[model samples]
Target: MLRAMRYLDYAATTPVLPEVTDAMVAVLTGDFGNPSSVHAYGRAAREIVEDARDRVASAVGASPAEIVFTAGGTEADNLAIKGATRKLRGNGNHVITTAFEHHAVLDTVEWLGHDEFETTVLPVGPDGLVDPAAVAAAVRPSTILVSIMAVNNEIGTAQPLAEIARAVKGANPSTLVHTDAVQMLGNLPVNVHELGLDFAAFSAHKFGGPKGVGFLFARSHAPVEALLHGGGHEGGLRSGTLNVPGLAGLGVAAEIAAKEVDHKIERVGGLRTRLWQGIEDSIERVRLNGHPTERVPGTLNVSFEGADGETLLLLFDAAGIACSAGSACQSGAIDPSHVLLAIGVPREIAKGSVRFSLGRESTDEDVDAVLEVLPGIVESARRVG
Candidate 1:
């Protein structure tokens, strides 16, 4: 028999839950009408879409009307950053974000900066945390928006969104706050109102739902412009035929997550701790790459002093272990991780880092498998490097 693959890359994407799959199959077979068409069949399809909207909103503590479905987390980030800035540009041309963000946000802001916007890319501390006070200090009267990610996909560090939002608003009440929260939904409870956020982005696939469907939480009063214009679907923000089956899957996943996230967090946290402890006790010179206590429970980033990260990944793959050198988006790039470099990791150390992210289905056996195999893999990779 083939060896079972020990998967540890949930931060890249998660397997769709069985319930989500069943929900999607049901919609695929039964609700195949265009939701915008005015017929009984269309009405039934519209109900499925709207009910999913409500379920997604409830999971994130937002109103159903505020959730604008999009293609995925990248589109949600693009819409939130670009759409919001376009709408608010009349107020100011200045925008602020961090040094290390997903390219969806970083690239969007970079493109805007090339045009008419004055952009501020703030530096993160060595511990992978952004200081709220620095955000307040960066806020100018002409600053229109501030975008930050709730959790770093590479390091699993959770930013203090509430504090950052409060700081931004205190400095300029008109400056809007947005977060690329694609990594937050499955790891923590996200409440847009409680966090004082004007916008937030999420992807269903990151949390056990189907891929290619996600939503943007645009607060009721937030000013946002249409990125895709056509028949004016999604309140005219994103116009396209709805992915009914994907939305149905997303709804079920959200509902299940709302009930089980706490338990998942606890269980995954324990597994991550064991994995880290095992590596620490067994390996000679591995460094943990994020804030010890201020990160999500499911992720652990480590750097082995003398091994190349790419080589480590290859050996791990050959050994039937799945993991990543950094964000899946930057999978094959030659450079070290921007997040690690931003947090003051030495270039050599950064080049040797890898990430292990657990999920709801991860268990003690997975941890045991990693511990049993990792030391030899590291040794082999070090000699090869």
Candidate 2:
């Protein structure tokens, strides 16, 4: 007999909701038309895309005109980081970002540093936070853009984006600010204006929608150069045939996620606390990663003192549980998570950390299931290591 499988990796990705699936199927089966064409079929398809744009915008407190559809979070990050920097390069060539940002931001900034732009990669404290003062201090008159992530994907610590933005602006009013908010939307409240962000990136899959679709919130005044050149889609910023079915799914997912964020936060947060408390009570020499109070509710990163994280993950899989050692993007990498290292986790302890993320559908039973077997899993992993 097979053991029941429990999923606890929502930060990596989420299962598409039934409503989102229904919306996508409706589009794929019936509304198969080119949004750019003038025919009746095209008009219907265009409406689906536009409505989805509006839904996504409303979810993040943005205007439909400001939402630029992209392949996913990475594209959005590239557009926000590379496009913005390229467009504003004439004003300055310096860009600033923290060490804990998603690779989408860090790698892009690093790439730019090799040629056209001068980049500063700021450091974070052991608590996985970038000090706003540090960001302000890094600002030079030549700084054109500062890219930060609203949430750290590995540790689940929420950065002080508003404060950081304010600090950056105070230092250099001309400098544009961008945030990789892929891990933030649907899991937390994201208002572009309230956060004072010039650009923000989000992924639909993070919020119960399908993969391969996401959007960027670029304030009207904040112009970014086009990465793809074609039919001038997405206000000529991103060009390609829009994914009608994916857009439909994204809309429904964003709407539902926004509507239920408070409830999900409370419920999922309780489950996360329960799981952590259980592990703390049952296990010894374990450390909780990230902030205790100011993090997204669903993600819990924990380090076992003597157990290997990879071994624990494999053992958990064998026990019919699913989790990740770190960001899904860096699954096969040999180095300890850069996020962990930036936060000052010892190399060995960083290698022994696992990230367990909950979602709206996570339940007490899921918590109980993990609690039941985690002690044994850790013990076995320690022995093997």
User: Can you give the TM-score per candidate against the true fold?
Assistant: 0.98, 0.98
Clashing residue pairs in candidate 2 are none
Q: Candidate 2, residues 247-336: lDDT per residue as tens digits?
A: 999999999999998988899999999999999999999999988888999999999988898899999999888999989999986468
Could you tell me the C-alpha RMSD of candidate 2 in Å? 1.2
The 0-to-1 C-alpha lDDT of every candidate, in the order given, reads 0.93, 0.92
Please give the RMSD to the true structure for each candidate, in Å.
1.1, 1.2
Q: Please tell me which predicted candidate would have the highest lDDT against the true structure.
A: 1
Model 2: per-residue Cα lDDT at residue 176: 93
Candidate 1 weakest ten by summed lDDT: 255-264
lDDT per residue (tens digit) for residues 1-385 in model 1: 8688989999999999999999999988888999999999899999999999999999999999999999999999989889988988889999999998998999999999988899999999988999999999999999999999999999999999999999999999999999999999979888899999999999999999999999999999799998998989999999999999999999989878877878888889999999999999999989999899888889999999989999989889988889999899899674799999999999998888999999999989899988998989999978987
